[model samples]
Target chain A: MHEDRQQFIQGVRDCLPTLLGYIGIGAAFGIVGASSNVSLLEIALLSLLVYAGSAQFIICALFVVHTPIPVIVATTFIVNLRHFLMGLAIAPAFSQYSMKQNVLLGTLLTDETFGVAASKLTKQTKLNASWMHGLNITAYLCWLLSSLAGAMLGQWIEEPTVFGLDFALPAMFVALLIIQLQQQAAGKLMHLLAVVGYTIIFMVVFSFVVPSHLAVLLSTMSAATIGVLTKR
Target chain B: MTISTTMLLIIIGCCLVTLIPRIAPFILLKKVSLPKWMTDWLSYIPICILTALIVQGMWTAEQGKLIISWHYMLALIPTVIAALWTRSLAVTVIVGVVAMALVRMFS
Candidate 1:
């Protein structure tokens, strides 16, 4: 129980950077939702249940245009389809964890949390359910509360990115990624470079041909396949 | 802000769509054992996905074309240094925020 407490604390600590980013973006989402004429209660519910930032943001835009409900639902599914891959990627690590634990973990898994946990896993750090909950619930709370506050703040700021908060997502990803590569790439630097280089090139080319989200999924899956094939 | 029936439906619908994709794999894989190659492939996914995100996040899409945001690219210099030097997620994030703020303020 004591170690569980420690793991929980560590998870919360690991999520601190994610917390800062969430506060700004969550509130910005709230402001956007409010300004878009969605009610505070609606925004709150969306944040609580839907919980995907991009999906919720798109929902607000669609609400204004009165896009057909079926269309919105389909778009939401497509926009978040990448999560299936994310869940598959992280599942093996949680194999020892119970179904209940995996359910909760899967529910709260976001790009940031996945990257942070994956980065830690690369360091051979041990993670328990409590840690996962601490990391997830803390981020979830920040998102919920901040968005509610932003909804109440009532849309005075036109663009929250003026404070450069939008950079957090990419920054967090890059930091996790750099650490992962540095830890694992020591022996085969060229192999690592090839994988990363392939990803960038594929993403750029795919973006030109497909939607950006689809581009990300295609590039990631294919590049990882390449990493597997070229493994020595 | 009164909640409308339509809005309620939208929220509910969005919730289902969002949750299904996120939770599907966990449910499907619960009783199955993964193959060795699958595990190896999954191991590479973290880096691949992260790289894909960073590449796309640095660019803005317009009129079916991608335009680079020099501000973000400029700010990445310090952030990457922070990551390599300290390898602390929190420190790198703080440095990134400050670096981006400076980039935005100056130009």
Candidate 2:
């Protein structure tokens, strides 16, 4: 039990970097939701429930455009479809845990948490529910609280874009992806580059015809398939 | 804006859609054994998804016309460098945002 507590604390420590980025993005989100006349409670609930940065932004944008409900729902579904893969990727680590535990843990999984958890898994080679709990819950709390703060403080910041806060998500992703890539074998860099090209091409081509989120799903699946085929 | 019945419905719909995709896979696949090849494929999902998302964020279609934001592209360079050098998410984001703010200020 003591060891579990230690691991859990470590998980939260690992999430410190994410906390900084989340506050910036979450605050930006709060500002948008506030200006859109979205109630503070609703904004907080959206952060609490939806818990996705890009998807929440899309939801706000769609609402601003007055897009139809069904379309908005469908778009959110497609955009979030990738979370299935994220859950799947970490499934093996939690295989020993109960289904209920997995379900609970899965709820806290996000792109940043997935990256952090996956990286830890690659190194630790053991599944500690406490560690995963600490990592995920810390990130989740940061997102929820920071967004709430953003919503409440919405009027204070007029233009997040002028300050370049919009780049937070992409910057985080780029860093995370690079870290993952750096961990791979040098010989596999070429294969990784090819996989990137394959993924981007599929995304660009499919995005023209399909809804943007669906295009992401299709392209990611194709890229993964290509990775599987090329692996020795 | 105040929440209306229609907005509530939309929010619920969004919640259901997000919840199902995120929570279902682990529950459904918990006991089932996945193929080895499938596991291999799963490894690439992160890269593909992140790249696709970043690209989508950097460019978008407006009125059926594709428009690229050169500012984001410019910011990406410094961000990439900082990420590679520091491998710190906080530093990379700070540098990227600063780079972008500078670009927007000048141009």
Candidate 3:
């Protein structure tokens, strides 16, 4: 127990840099959501619950479109389906953990957490549960605080888009994708196929769709399908 | 438009749908072994979904009009270059914003 606590502290220290990035990005998201006329409560809810950056951005866009409830729900489900895969990919690493521990850790699983944890697992035999938990918790806390700050200050900023804030979400993803491709084995090919498939589906469907939500839903489903079919 | 009860309900519904998938894995994956094929496919979803989103964001205008404007083209130049060279999230986003702003200004 003592050793676990120490390792967890170390994990938090190591993950600090990554956590800072999530804060900045998450705050930007909060600002965007606020600027889109979403209420402070909604922004907070999204920050705490949705947690997925890109999906939150899309949700805000749907809000702007005043999309129907059913469509919005469907779109959110599709966009976040990747989280399921992320959870599964990390399952083997946590096989020894109790179901409660898995559930707790799973709640904190994000792209950043998974990347760091998976890399760590590859290098070491025995997992440091505390450190893993600490890393994820630190990131999650940063995200929540940053989002709250953004929501509070969002109304004061008249033009987030004019400040070029709208570009951050996509830019962040592109950057992350590029880095992931360079570092992970087979990352480039997998990411390239995913991107190409998504783009084709979005372009084909978006033009004819009335509610923009459909474009996101269909594209995400198509991507998931492609991902499932081509898995190693 | 007034904040109608209907709209509020819609928002609540949307929230539930979004939260379920994220929450489900924590519950379901705890006891089950996901098939190998499923695992393989899930790996690719992020890249594909992100690509579709970014391309659409860069190209589409209001009402789905495709605009191959010089501003967008110019913005892409810096974005692509920054993404490939730096591969840093902050750098890429900063460059993209700067590129778009410059394109919007000069054009």
Candidate 4:
């Protein structure tokens, strides 16, 4: 097999766990979308185009409350601002690809993809464009299709939590964090601990005062700064 | 459910909001040179962001109060162990799902 083919296959293989988690969240999003007085087509389009799980959920909640259009748009933008950081984090690796390829990869860079790619790229020195495409495309399809299933069967699976599917996303994230933590340099552990500690405290104290999206952004920035300053 | 004009605009606005963040960095920063300090700081982005996301996932705010769910914390035990022991994302997720399901089933 060609090296690129092998890398692509490996990328798909690595995404299997994330796919399992996405299946549940995507369906939940679909169910919520269906119940929010939006057409199935609109729900599907949102998943296909917007493609951010938390942001989509927030949009649905605001939509149900009949939030003003500007508020909804602004909230979604703030919720998704983390993607800007994700994009910058991966920019160096993607510098090797063409503008068109970068566009495609950027569109597909969800939290799961960013998590998987960040760890994978850190371990390997070379940039595998096809491998990344494989990973992103697989995750993208899982999210889109599972969401479609949820929308189609929204009524039937009214309570997705009954089956413990709500835990899928958290579990997936925990797993990703563990992997990333294990890959960190020995001296970096202190920074990791500080970042985790600071973020928890920030979230607990400010979750009510600030919008959740802004809280997230603030916590992330602070944690990254803590890491940078503490790094030797 | 039927779509209204407002919903359509919100969707389009959402598309733009998400698209710009994802696409802009790749386009603008692709050829731009970043300082070593900036790159070192960027290295922390994933760990910091993921940590914050995990914390956010743990407890949700209800009526302006933080409600911590013991269930999520319990499930993380097995999930973290599986992640460390197996080092396999699939196995870790499966263990986590099964652990949570069992907890929900019995508790």
Q: Pick the candidate with the highest lDDT.
A: 1
Show model 2 residue runs off by greater than 4 Å.
A124-126, B62-65
Residue range A113-186, candidate 1, lDDT tens digits: 88878877876634577898889899998899988998887667766666666676677777888888887756
**Location of the lowest summed lDDT over 10 successive residues in candidate 1 chain A:** A119-128
What local lDDT score does residue B57 receive in model 2, on the 0 to 100 scale? 61
What do the candidate models score in CA lDDT, each in turn?
0.83, 0.82, 0.65, 0.83
Off by over 4 Å in 4: A1-4, B62-64
**TM-score: which candidate is best?**
2
Native-vs-model 3 lDDT?
Answer: 0.65
iRMS (Å) per candidate: 1.7, 1.8, 4.5, 1.9
Cα misplacement distance, residue A226 of candidate 1 (Å)? 0.8
For model 2 chain A, the run of ten residues with the poorest summed lDDT: A117-126
| Per-model TM-score on C-alpha atoms | 0.91, 0.94, 0.71, 0.92
Candidate 4, residues A14-48, lDDT tens digits: the string is 77768988998898788887777667888888888
DockQ-based CAPRI category assigned to the predicted complex of candidate 3: acceptable
Docking class of 1: medium
Task: Provide the lDDT at B19 for model 1.
Answer: 86
Deviation in angstroms for A162 in model 4?
A: 1.9
For A182-203, candidate 3 gives per-residue lDDT tens digits of: 5656754665555566556665
Instruction: Give, for candidate 3 chain A, the lowest lDDT window spanning 10 residues.
Output: A207-216
DockQ winner, 2 or 3: 2
Instruction: Please give, for every candidate in the order listed, the TM-score of chain B alone compared with the true chain B.
Output: 0.87, 0.88, 0.74, 0.86
Model 3: runs farther than 4 Å from truth?
A2-25, A28-42, A52-75, A110-132, A184-232, B1-12, B61-73, B105-107
